[model samples]
Target chain A: MKILLYIILVTILLATSSARYGVVAQQSKVREYRIANEHRILEEFVTLLSIPNVASDHVNIRRNAALIIEMMRRRGLEPRLLEAGNSVPPAIYGEWKVPGATRTIILYAHYDGQPTDPKQWAGTMPWQPTLRSAALEAGGTILSMPKPGEKIDPEWRLYARSASDDKAGVMAILTAVDALKAQGIAPTSNVKFFFEGEEEAGSSHLGDIIRDQKLLEADAWLICDGPVHQSGLKQVVFGVRGDTNVDLTVYGAKRPLHSGHYGNWSPNPGLILAKLLSSMKDEAGRVTIAGWYDDVAPLGETERRAIEEAPHYDNELKTQLGLARTENAGKSLLELINEPSLNINGMSSGDVGALARNVIPTTASAVLDLRLVKGT
Target chain B: MKILLYIILVTILLATSSARYGVVAQQSKVREYRIANEHRILEEFVTLLSIPNVASDHVNIRRNAALIIEMMRRRGLEPRLLEAGNSVPPAIYGEWKVPGATRTIILYAHYDGQPTDPKQWAGTMPWQPTLRSAALEAGGTILSMPKPGEKIDPEWRLYARSASDDKAGVMAILTAVDALKAQGIAPTSNVKFFFEGEEEAGSSHLGDIIRDQKLLEADAWLICDGPVHQSGLKQVVFGVRGDTNVDLTVYGAKRPLHSGHYGNWSPNPGLILAKLLSSMKDEAGRVTIAGWYDDVAPLGETERRAIEEAPHYDNELKTQLGLARTENAGKSLLELINEPSLNINGMSSGDVGALARNVIPTTASAVLDLRLVKGT
Candidate 1:
């Protein structure tokens, strides 16, 4: 009993000491400020998410930009719209200059989201910003937004099309600035905000926007996109894989033929596409295309070490994902991510389930997304 | 000029001799009858095609049965409905008894058609029975129905869901009877007409109906359904492949995940399914499954000779289909059809084209059709 007490006392003393100095001290201060204004931050986020912001939706996308500008203006930062030309969704730009700061950090986030079919969404609509007790897949129930005096649960998720993808990034960055101001904490570096409006449309005008805006130049860029780690842990990804999409279509007959009458005689486009795709990748998940891996650059020492040091959570992930086995049996996920990959974003031929008919479709199509590493 | 005249005279004489004693003589009588009452026959066919005869639509299916019964009665034959139980779609039965005949032949056709989606139909509605100059795929234009004095083109096609499938069978059979009676030609065999109302629903109660109806017994059954030969030549199929459908689905994460964040890490269901299906067949279009071809019955000497004697129109077919190559490279389509085959009737994973989102879908599914030969 005496030893246990002693151990507890030592733990408390060490924690208290760490709270007074080091990264823990800074984190504690940020947390306190965030907790104090969590409700307001969440409400603002909900409002932002309620806007329909598909990149190709010109009217709604402009609305998103206007609202984001208002969000920056409320913080006393003068925001401007950066556009390539007329009718294009503009980038919202703002900056906070710190006196005596030697570096300028550009914070990047996108406002537009991927196009979604309304019929594909579950009970909630894409732009409705429905709050759920948890994830919908986890039997989450919709909850009414909290009133002014009510406390909120951090675990509750706001369900919307871009709730997690990029709107969350914008919300988090803006909230972090609010927290710093509320706590009277000064940032060591000048921060510039660059909220993009057409990332989902492949950022076609991003180069022009950057080239035309001279003030956007910074020492380094901190991009806030993607999701939290699959293990629900915070992670920092230094480099992102470059993406290229290819739309592939295979042809069968000129018209759909009854499967029973001409199945074997007619070439099935779906099977042809499958065979073509299979030829590109082997059973071990390695791509077999000629010259596919030839141009890949060797990993640097730092990258190699980082991969080796990363957690070995494949077993835990497999259990959570309900997978008995993964492709490329023995390779770790950290090891796999560093390599180039060929993934099928979407594939279709005829129809399945209730809409399925016994017809050999005229064409089968697949959208393949190739994620390139540093070299290829 | 004298030599040309002599050649023409010889050609005319030979053609007349062949028409008098060859297959043309048998076809000439049917042709004369069809040509005499073409307008009425076409109008009757259009009226029958106008009825929605999806087997599941009980009211429409019964209406089809009643109309068919009326048609048989008009020809002075006794007609009745054969049913297993109440509320089920019944088979329309009618018979023409030939005195002193040693054989009875049953002419089988179905009134019910495959369920159709109105939106999937081109130009014409499922039961509207519109006339077209050609197939919709061949850029056919909708044409007005012929008036009493208007000349009808034999090449013109009637467009409806079941226009050519089985309704055409019903119309042709009845018209043949009319032609025979008008020409004072008697059929040697006692002809029995059996029109099923639920063929598209797998003829679930056909066995029961046959067992309950004593007059259904016949020495021969001539089934009139399916398409004309791909070569547009009259052909008969002696045996049909037994069909079995298997639905296959592969799993990914429990919910959709951003492809950018977890693409390489998360096993994509589409890719997994593609790999699985690819494993079933080789590059040469031969199934690699352990027992896929093991149980296939070998073709007899007669069947082999028949296949060899069939017209080799594969080159013309390939050109029409815009195919540079076919599966099982050197083998003829006739040889391939004799073997049991596997085909993907339909497959789906997420959405393609504009509706496609950058997410790894939860599941990918495929409808696989396996065509079986004897002993398989």
Candidate 2:
């Protein structure tokens, strides 16, 4: 009887080990596929960039969306164009269902780019791609801050429109899938692709798309629009912060009051707004809203551990950022990058620069972007 | 012997009490003088507002500075005018000595006002001081945002350039001094005034002057620039945030690149800069710079306690702020307002608005305004 019990235990252990091995093998295949097809991904991204998909004048927005759909269909995937809103360009969705897969993952990217100006472009037109020696880069239209002890490698850059912002990312995703199919490997989990065209214009219609379609039901959602972090490490991002944009107007008198007469007695709405904003935060980067942090989600243990484990630069890297010191000192890189934030995007009051006037401005408007953490 | 001792004690106690009462009586007199002179302060503010002291247009700025100096001399104070810079306007300095005073406070105000457009002002010009009905307080160039809940009381408002800014504050200080003089009361502390003309032009030369002149020495500085808190409470501010403006350019190639050919491989500087900025701050208000907060002076117990004790709006007030929830939702008013912040004052790349082209911008630029707290 003891021998029989030992045999059963051994058998169970062997089966569990084999299953784990299979899973590891599958993950390895995915990694290998992505690595080998980097060049192919680059090519595809270049092709997409060739298309003029400027958001405001969207002559090519639909064309690019259709092209993406065609690519997906050519790979034996069922793809559809989703007209989420009246004014916005359509979203392209493609799905591959592996029979009996219990989980699903959705990939997202944007296909639109900002319009170009001919005057701003020096070597090549805004639409034409150009290559330059690293030394010539400094003279290009875009100016980069000279970093200490840093040398630019001209060969590494492919200068063009929409390359890094999102097109490259999109290409990376497609190429990654294409590589898997070429290797005769079927994905373990069902996959869905979402290509949006309105991200450049605030994604104004995205919320509606999310609510109405119910089409993107998946176990996980992956945003493929952002670039790889500076460290160039393969990242697994679990969450993103929510955002809200606000325009606040503080009204004073019906008209602009003379600063001389009303400076101390009557209120200057601009100063009032400044004082109000100042009251919301202190010198140490702590927020001052009455209940601003009451519901803030604390960093979880797993996240903290992962962040600590991630590769990071020391003082040398900090200097590259031109930062004498970090803002939220002592926090890990991951914590800072993944956390939520609030920012004053822009503020306009009266005249600015040589045109600055001392009139107590009648109206001061500020554009604020507030970012929220996943749990908070 | 015991009775004699009691008698002596009683006499000493009476003498001490009388001395204390004398000091208290003097303080009450001064307080009453200030209160009684409130109307005079308003009147002086209005008078100052009548002058056209637009900084951009030089003629009135010097005139107003001269007027301020003349007024100071009339008050038995020594006034001097110093050129801000060879190109900029002049600044006025005034000093008064109070016998036996151990402390000195520097008072700051600007004489220049913002330029006004005649087309925007209704029923009055920018330089004309008009007293409209109590229901109409806003009048000037289209710059000023009207004060909320500000009763358009003709009795309260003086319509002219520089009405509520430094002009009115300067008038208030002068009027306060006048009231004290009339009551045969003098300032308990030595007073020094630093009236600036180019403050409307960024106070560019003020820093150099502050560093060079011992004539402006004082124990503390008082900047009567911005208004009181939105709650109408009187506040004594101890510090002002310093600002640094940076124009960052992203260099791509010598010329704008066509999006089609090099989209994936080319380095688009605009996209790069945007990504760079986006990466610096996460969804939360936290900046991602390493050690950014190390140099920041933490809020002291005394300061925090004082801020907590100060009057503040709770949930109802926040609701009135038009916020469903505040940014950094759990922070105190003191914590959020006093913190250092980075603002994207403006960003330009290719075409930002309706004019969308497909060219890769050669250069992208962004204007950054960093608000510095203590240690920054």
User: DockQ, in order, for the candidates?
Assistant: 0.46, 0.03
Write one digit per residue (lDDT tens) for candidate 2, span B1-376. 1111122222222222447676466446545654454444445555677777766666767778778888899897789887746556788888878889898887777888655567766667877666553324333233232244333322334556666655766775666566557867566678888888877556778877777787888887766666555464445555766666666676665554434322322344544455555554444445566876678787788878877887765454444433344334576445655676554433445542244333445665655545567887
lDDT score at residue A256, model 2, on the 0-100 scale: 47
lDDT to native, each model: 0.78, 0.57
Q: What is the lDDT of candidate 2?
A: 0.57
Give the per-residue lDDT digits (tens) of candidate 2, residues A220-288. Answer: 777765434445434545565565555656554444433332222223344344444445444433456
Query: What is the interface root-mean-square deviation of candidate 1?
Result: 1.9
TM-scores for every candidate against the unseen true structure: 0.88, 0.45
lDDT of 1 by residue, A1-376 (tens): 1111122222223222444465456555655655677678778888998999998888999999999999999996789999998778899999988999898888788999989988888898999988888877788899999888787776777788788778877877777777667657667778888999998888889999999889998998877775555565555678887777789999889888787776667788998888887777777778788998898898899998988887678899788878777766687887777788888888999878765777788999998888788889
Question: What's the lDDT of the predicted structure labeled candidate 1?
Answer: 0.78
In order, the B-chain TM-scores come to 0.89, 0.70
Candidate 1, after superposition: displacement of residue B332 in Å? 3.5
Q: Let me know the TM-score candidate 2 reaches against the reference structure.
A: 0.45
